[model samples]
Structure formats: structure tokens, C-alpha cells
Target: MKNKILVLGSLTLLSASLLVMNSCNSLPKGLKTIQDFDKNKYLGSWYEIARLDFVFEKNLNNTTAEYSLNEDGSIKVVNRGYNFIKNKYVASTGKVKFAGDSNEGKLKVSFFGPFYSGYNIIALDSDYKYALVAGESLKYLWLLSREKTMPNNIKETYLKTAKDLGYNTSELIWVKHN
Candidate 1:
């Protein structure tokens, strides 16, 4: 009876762990990752043109992210930004792996060990010059471009798309490249 009870407890714990891990890859309702995503083409530097204000990026300007292939088949994510208030540069390194199909832009990224968050590329241009990324929920969104500045047309279109998807576009903080 003791052995049976122990086995049951272990199984229960394993089930719960799997559930938590899977939830980290979930996308927000009505949001979708781009199909036919070419990871190789997407792996490069991107400037943060706009984003919804978040604690990790608070008071940050001139932000950028770089991605490279890691030896372990994961993507290395390096984010750098200038903290105007702190008068210093800040950076964070993380890892990203495809959440499901490699052809899809659905990924899970983790800066902290054993905890992952959704990184869904909701929109991307054919040339890979601009991308609109959404997080696990409506509260997280980013407008990324290969250059420091995005074209006005692209910006307006992305904003409209975000708004259509129930995002609060007004809450976005336009990041300064300088």
C-alpha cells in the first residue's frame, strides 16, 4: 500500500508539471503566430520601436535585441537598452525554442531558469524588415524593425492590427533609438 501511494503521488506531480510547461507556450486569444516563418532569415538584430510598458523594460530607451543560433538548437536572445534614469546600459540574455512546429513563429523564451513565456510573432514582412510580436496575452506587444526607425505606413498598419486584436494601442511606449 505504501509503494502504491508513492507511485500515485509521483504521477500526480508529473502531470501537474507538464500542464505548467505547456501553458507557457499558449498564445493570447485571437492572436496567432505567422506561418512559414524562416528562422534563419529572422535571426538577426532588431530595434525596439514600440512596446507596451512592462516592468522589465521600464524607462528603457534605445533598445535592441539580437538573436543567434545556439549550439543546442535553441536561439540565443540578447536584449540591450539604455536606461535614461540610471544613465547606463542594461542587458539581458535568454534562450528561445520553438513551442511547436519549426515553421511557425510560435516560441517559448526564458530569461529565468525553468520558467518560459510565449514569444509569438504575429506579423512579419516578406523581407524580414519589420515584425509585430505578441506575448502570452494582450498586455504584451512589441513593434520591431531591422532599422532604428519604422516607416509611418508600417507603424500605422501595425497599430491598427494590434487594435483589432483587442490590444490597447494607446498604452504603447514609443522607444527612442538615440
Candidate 2:
């Protein structure tokens, strides 16, 4: 009967959904939020220590991001980098706005048209020496610094932190600078 066919179709769709989730293709495991992100001290230059090899900065060196508060209560985000392979300097400007009162550190940034994406300040050092950023998902984590280089111990600690948040540290692409 029609009811029997409908039931079988629903079961098949449910099994397919479970199969896709088990594959782990899109959504990833990652941290939820930063305990307390100091807005004042965190607004400054931050070098890209490790990234997910995103297209915006592929083969780029001396990658750095600068954040400043705008007059309109928005965060001015500027990402600059030198492309070693292309022998060029690239700069992309964007705007970041806070989510709401309940989501202080959670933010939305727009770089490619009207589509805004999550940019959360997951972890930060007391002195702002290092920071862990989550770009909406586990596959979009980044280790940043005020300087071009990070200490070995610091790198280890950061990797561990990222791992604890359900991220795979081995997938991180270490960005080398000139």
C-alpha cells in the first residue's frame, strides 16, 4: 500500500543521513569559545602560524592580520600576506561584528560578498603573545602570533589545546615565513 511505501522511503532516507554523518565530510569537531577574550589587548597585529591552507592565503608568506575597532562599533579586519610562490603582496579587508550580549567573543566577518561567516576567538594568551582562532569549524582553526615565529613549547601547547577541542592537529599546515 501507499503507507508501506512511504514508511520504507523514510527509513531509507534516515539511513542515508546516518551514513553521511559517519563520513564526516562537512562539519568538523572544534572548540566552542574562548574563556575571556580581552578586546582591548587583542586588537593588533597577529601573524599566521598555522592555517588550513585556505585559498585566501595559499603559498603566502609573512601572513599577518590586523584588527582595529571602527567608529561604527565594528571590528576592522585587514589581512595581508606576501605570496612567496607568486612573488606578490596580497591584502584583503573585511569587517567583523560581534554576535550579541550573550556572545561577546563570537563574531561574524564578511570577506566574500554578503555571506558572513563565524569567526570566534577561541583561546588567547594573557599577554596576547599567542591566540587560537576558530573559523566556524574544526577544519578552520588557526594559530596566530604577534611575531613571525612561535616557540616550540608554545606550539605544542597550542596543538594540544586544538586537539582537546576535537580537532586533528596533524592536518594543520604549518606556515613558514621568510
Q: List the residue pairs that clash in candidate 2.
A: none
Output candidate 1 Cα RMSD: 3.8
Please report, in order, the local distance difference test score of every candidate based on alpha carbons: 0.93, 0.77
Give per-model TM-scores.
0.88, 0.77
**Clash pairs detected, candidate 1:** none
Our tally of clashes for model 2 stands at 0
Kindly give the stretch of ten consecutive residues in candidate 1 with the minimal lDDT sum.
18-27
Task: Count backbone clashes in candidate 1.
Answer: 0
Write model 2 residue lDDT over 8-99, tens digit each, in one string: 99999988876643331222354456656566677889999998777777888788999998998677889998888888999999987765
- Candidate 1 stretches with Cα past 4 Å from truth are 1-22
Q: Name the weakest run of 10 consecutive residues (lDDT summed) in model 2.
A: 21-30
Q: Candidate 1 lDDT, tens digit per residue, 1-178?
A: 9999999999999999867865767777888889999999999999999999999999999999999999988999999999999999999999999998999999989888767888999999999999999999898999999999999999999999999999999999999987
Report the Cα lDDT for candidate 1: 0.93
Give residue 44's lDDT in candidate 1 (0 to 100). 93
